[model samples]
Target chain A: MKLTRRMFIQGAAAVTALMAAPRALLAWPEKAFKAGSSDEVMQALFGSADVTESGSVVLNAPDIAENGRVVPISVSSSLDGVENISVIVVENPSPLAASFDLGPGASAAVSTRIKMGKTSNVIAVVKADGKLYSAQKEVKVTIGGCGG
Target chain B: MASDIRIKAKLTGDTAEVKTLMKHDMETGTRKDKKTGETVPAHYITEVKCELNGKLVMTANWGPAVSKNPYFAFTVKGAKAGDVLKVSWVDNKGGGSSAETTLG
Candidate 1:
């Protein structure tokens, strides 16, 4: 077999075709993602919407997000016996963003990037000693980044 | 083959700052293919865990709302140089990957 320009083009087309094929597997939160309000999403995710504001739970985020598609967020708790952490965007269609379960040996800190539909309050909820403590920061999103 | 996840852990004073970048699409299933005009199926990491010297340091639960090729960073208190750090993840499709490094 001899290499030719035609063969190279054919190979490139084959590679593109393979990439275009639909991927299989994976499950998503259909009901939770479809929820219209923060309360509904919170109820579906954590079984409650009532979170007490606390200064011990520190939420670090930008005051004005350059983009909504990738907003950096970090959470840390100084409270003892903290076992879990949760992130929420109060103005998004499906507000419950992310959650973490910390083990006894694990430190009470987490960081990740999240998408927001618009300007909203970013909330960090830390579960310690079976009680929920939270902190919030308002982030203004720029044009055309995440969600509708 | 499981995709390779890149991780780095370095000591900053008594704390260890860790950074991770994983190769993934993180599809939300809401976006449509421009050519075929069909909704893409959801595929994203649902969980992530980090450990320091064999002890759990952090764990995260994620959703499709996260961006593609996710990047994460955090710090572990009381960590020091030469300590072992490990990071692992499992996607919604049951796919998983892991990587480990010694704090430098």
Candidate 2:
């Protein structure tokens, strides 16, 4: 009876670990997210802030956002071998909003909603063929999103 | 409990567009409560993963700047109408949720 109970406990523990193994493998970039500025974020995540302005990278955002709480933003790249795309709000306290890593079978575009703390330049950074390219658009916010 | 993720997928030609909306407060941890005068703890989705027919295709890393009820959209290549698309997210507080949909 004692042996059976011990085996059951060990089985349960193994199952729990198996269930969590996948997520644990994809470790979150905590340092990049906590970086206060766009330059810092780039350094923390990509090891450099060097990015060339590119026309192939398109950043779509409103000229004036009535609601800063939910601003629609979309980014697309015509460049081949696009592996990663990141959105940055320059004026936000923490500028690195989101980053998307695309597999080979995935396209080089993404659309999402982000919060803007104030009027800021929204930048789309694309990593294609191991090189970083960026595009930026200034968005005016009537109301801030980070206020309490 | 009801699933916190809503997913929609459509196959156009050889490409499949997958869109997902996740329910999350995404508290920035900088907001103060009006009644209690205490700052709200940070609660936000930090990672999201997308799979096409059980194969990983895309991974999204998000920060607090992502708005509440995050909406994300991406496209996958070489997908069929009946293919299954799965999306899951994990929050900073260790909470997670997932949902799947068949491509139309």
The fnat of each candidate, in order, is 0.55, 0.91
Segments of candidate 2 deviating more than 4 angstroms: A1-25
Residue pairs clashing, model 2: none
Name every residue pair that clashes in candidate 1: none
**Which candidate has the highest DockQ of all?**
2
TM-score of chain A of each: 0.72, 0.83
Measured by lDDT, the strongest candidate is 2
The digit string of per-residue lDDT tens for model 2 on A1-148 reads 9999999999999999999899667878788888988999888878889999999999999999999999999999999999999999999999999999899879999999999999999999999998899999999999999965
Mind giving the per-residue lDDT tens digits that candidate 2 earns over B1-104? Answer: 23789887878998988888899999999999999999999999999999988998999999999999999999999898888888988898889988888887
Candidate 1 ranges beyond 4 A from true positions:
A1-36, A40-47, B1-3, B12-14, B78-81
Error of 2 at B2 (Å): 5.5
Residue B72 in candidate 1 has what lDDT?
A: 81
TM-score to native of every candidate shown: 0.77, 0.89
Per-candidate DockQ vs. reference: 0.32, 0.72
**Worst ten-residue run, lDDT, model 2 chain A?**
A23-32
Candidate 2 CAPRI-style tier: medium
